[model samples]
Target: MDGDYVIGGVFSFHYYMHTVKHNYTTMPEPLSCAGSINSRGLRFSRAMVFAIEQINNSTKLLPGIKLGYEIYDSCASVSVAVNVAFQLSGGLDPVFNTGDKCSQSGMVLAVVGASGSTRSISMSRIIGPFNIPQRVADVIRRSTAKVVVAFISTGDMKILLEELSRKPSPPRQWIGSESWVTDRDMLRFSFLAGAIGFGIEKSVIPGLRDFLLDLSPSKVADSPLLTMFWEEAFNCRLVKSEATDRSVCDGTEDIKTLRAHTLTHLISTSNH
Candidate 1:
């Protein structure tokens, strides 16, 4: 989507950045993300896009203007989020050819969705000075308590859970904040079986289900990110199969036929 004014969004779409070893040799390669995509993060990002599109389509809201967005993946790292914040703030200049006409680029009107408390804090330090409004951290371990309570977002909670999963600890009762209490990703942890918390009441957004299901391979041909998302969700490949074992998608897969658990929140609610 493109508009007269652009907004920025940052989310922990990936759990971590691919590790790189710097030998103080040549310039390091650009950072890449690893780990399975975070569904909750994806949901938050799509909601933003959906809302923006809705506003753009309405005649009564910002009648003559359109809104665009530049979304970045934080990779669940404070450094990555801060780096993206700089880009959103126009701190990094874009390079252009001497032969090409250059003009001032569009700046983001505001930013939304940092996805985690620590990432939000780190990002605010960079964009706050510019008057950008933003919408929306860690620890644990070595303690002897039989129970643990976490008030952090799902991104931070995932990191904590990973650390705790690596070691043998007593069966501890877990208390989660609304952020992660109802997150499907958190449910994968057997240790959180007895966890208790309240999630914000879910809201219904009429036609949102159709909005998500209406995606087509041709519609997202230019975006590798969306293509990857389609592949992951449908368990098929849109691009040429690099591996002999992979299944190439036919582009006719019906999203409506997908199991309820495959995209429950995405199809049923606007909750984050």
Candidate 2:
């Protein structure tokens, strides 16, 4: 593996089943990627491939070094994420505390994403040790792991908080996604004070706004994903703010300069 940068990636693309007992469905076991890829997982994996291509094509970023990656699926489970994390830590396959515990040098220099927080937390215990940024990593054994949390939903936030609360550390500086920035339930957690979050980042994607406004199922008959997204844009799957909880899709929505991103709102607690 004559690679320069080993960027480890994690994505949850499928639903996980606990047991494959006669009643349960069958699928690949932990530490395996033999299962069929899901739509969401495909989307994420493609994005990463596109990004790596862009980075490789660019001469400015890496200079002479090539950028490479090792992407794994978390299967939407903490146990699965932990399994993926060890693969990222190095070549620790079929790893058990009791047998064949030899860890090899993995090809990754840094990790990219694990959309769910529980997965992120479970993996962090392993991902935290490996120093990213090869030049500095060459000399240091232990360094600050740069952790970024994005698209971590409210449910995952609760699990993350509960885990942290058990072994309460010093107040951590938190960076959050718009998803849970203003969640009232989370605000009640005293430990989350001073956490900062970013909302969606909006940009005029030249003609994209117009395209979305005019988008319809008939227009995108070739793509099923786009068709469903069209409905999502105008349909209220969940409760809408200050409005009746309608069970129908209203096509009267404005697709203007969409609030693509959000502004950060600091949590006000008794002590920062």
TM for every model, in the order presented, reads 0.81, 0.42
Q: Count of backbone clashes for each model?
A: 0, 5
lDDT of 2 by residue, 23-120 (tens): 34675453433333333443455456556766687899767876766666676666677777877775535432213212334556778778676678
Q: Which 10-residue window in model 2 sums to the lowest lDDT?
A: 263-272
Model 1: per-residue Cα lDDT over 1-272, one tens digit each: 44678888998888788877778689977656788877667777878888899999899998999787777888887767877887777723342111212233566779996988888998988633232433211234445676777788877787777766776456768888888877767777775537888777767787676787777778756566667677777888887766845598887876677777767745554543
TM-score of 2: 0.42
- Model 2 ranges off by over 4 Å: 21-38, 92-105, 127-201, 204-272
Q: lDDT of each model, Cα atoms only?
A: 0.71, 0.52
Return the lDDT, model 1, position 194.
Answer: 72
Clashing pairs in 1: none
**Residue 239 error for model 1, in Å?**
2.5
TM-score computed on alpha carbons, candidate 1? 0.81
